[model samples]
Target: MGKKSATVVLAHGAWADTSSWGKVVVLLQSDGINAVTFRLPLTSLADDVTALDKVLALVDGPVVLVGHAYAGAVIAATHSAKVRALVYIAGLAPDQGETVADVFNRYEHDEKAPKLAPGDDGLMWLAPEAFGIAFAQHASPEEQKALAAKQLPISPAAITVPVERPLWKDVPAWYLLAQHDHMIPEKTQRFMAERMNAHISAYPVDHLPSVTAPELVATVIVDAVRFVDG
Candidate 1:
């Protein structure tokens, strides 16, 4: 593996903020990789992509853009030449003409998944009990509480927006499949990763592996950085 020199920009998914990548950031920096996390507003797809692009603009040299869940679509929307590679951590990767919702609803819904509902403001939020049962079953009681408290509501229109061109089509990509994910089915994840022809690392972790298994998440990201650096 090559030494760490590239910037690793992490994009968090829906119902999450930049703090979601906290542990992973620490690990990456400890390994001497320039790591930064982007905060998505969860308002609209275009808005999120613009936020990611701004972060990419400030980064120097080669970058390995990492996205978790919904942020996958955000990272894929970028056409930045500075981004040499892409990494998906149980992320959603939609193709041209297909909306994030289209790919998300492609498979049979998991029975254990949370019942999501939108508020009058057109924002969607997971049920309070969802944090422990569906979203992050492997997380501790305290960790789950923290996650629930910090949850960011997502706009319904964000998922409905279609992706024009996914950056994964041009950049080398890697995927870390969460086998125990309830938010996104494991089969759906595999299908998308295979379609993108991404180098995949399957793990027996839940949806929030970056929190429940930071070591594994950081390892996969570091490996992708090494590949890009080489």
Candidate 2:
């Protein structure tokens, strides 16, 4: 195999830590792709983007930034020239002047999806059952329990604030639409992908496919890396 010089930076979504990308990271490394997972503070869109920028600066080569669910907005909120391509896994993409809430709420939420509201801490959290019920229903009982235990809470500021001009407009983009995602409707994902002209790869997976269907997640990211490496 040819030497793969590009790096894949994985960003986890709301209510998740970097551990969510555990499976995908192992698979990318096995294929000789340098991969790293960036943890979002779930504070605000600006904070997450700033944190990602710091991680991008440390990498030595071009990058194929990959985001899952809500992290999709974090990955696109950067101005890093090193980021050559973007891969969105059941991600949310908002256009310029639009807020993440705008795009995420464009389509009606599934009845099974949880009603998210911030606790007294001013941070919104996902209920433990939501992991098994909607987030990653495909995941095993043990895995779902573990996923719920280490969850993070996202700030309303992160979703309510408007996104800047998206990097997908200029960078090559690949979208993995999760057909079974109850959180973000499949039709909503399609609308965003088509709006950005991203290459679409739909799969019968839930919102957290990076956790339940790592192979497919890795493949889409690898494809984006190859496109940039070429």
Candidate 3:
């Protein structure tokens, strides 16, 4: 497969899809780096990890896996030796035997997250109103509506299951703390960074930095890669 191209595989968070990355991917590609954003199944932790592994297997060279929100846990479980680094964007970076729910309940149990309840199909979906405030406050009113209309449901099991493997302990990590993030409170992001002992950066953007501040977010991810490369 020729020389494996250096790549950055972006994993989107729950309640969103690969398209949520939008301009952030463009910015990374503009830097002469290969950037790929994969759609998360968001159905179960095992399913998300399997999907990421499939995407990683397609990559030719060293990779940096970037995960947002719940995909942070997804990346942790799907990590491979080919991956050079990890970037967590206001996401969960749970250790082995640690669940997102455990982290949330530890830090701020009452924090306002999307009302995630299980469905008859045994998956967790967000309440529609959460799309406007929790998921897409930065988007235009119409844009938010459109996103809410197509939001993917996550599995309740994914939230409560601890990562079977925690890659952050092995790989170089970059944590971008969103100061104004409502979905995964700013304090919670900082706490995760501290736990991971990650290379830290910050933005005043909301939970979805890829949409609100793509340039800055991309710079953070790129900078992390360059730091490791150097």
Off by over 4 Å in 3: 1-5, 109-112
- Model 2, 85-117: lDDT tens digits are 999999999999999999999999889989988
Best first by lDDT, ranked = 2, 1, 3
For candidate 3, what is the TM-score? Answer: 0.91
* Candidate 1 stretches greater than 4 Å from native: 1-4
lDDT of 3 by residue, 1-230 (tens): 45554688999988888888878988988898888987887777888889899989988778888998888888888658888888998888877888987765555523556655688988777777776776767777887776777777787877888677688888879999888777777778888898888988987887788877788779878977786556
User: What's the lDDT of the predicted structure labeled candidate 3?
Assistant: 0.80
Q: Residue 55 deviation, candidate 1, in Å?
A: 0.8
Of candidate 2, the 10-residue stretch with the lowest lDDT total is 1-10
Residue 96, candidate 1: alpha-carbon lDDT:
94
Please list all clashing residue pairs in model 1, or write none if there are none: none
Q: lDDT tens string, model 1, 145-185?
A: 88888999999889998889899999889999999999999
List lDDT for all candidates, in order: 0.91, 0.93, 0.80
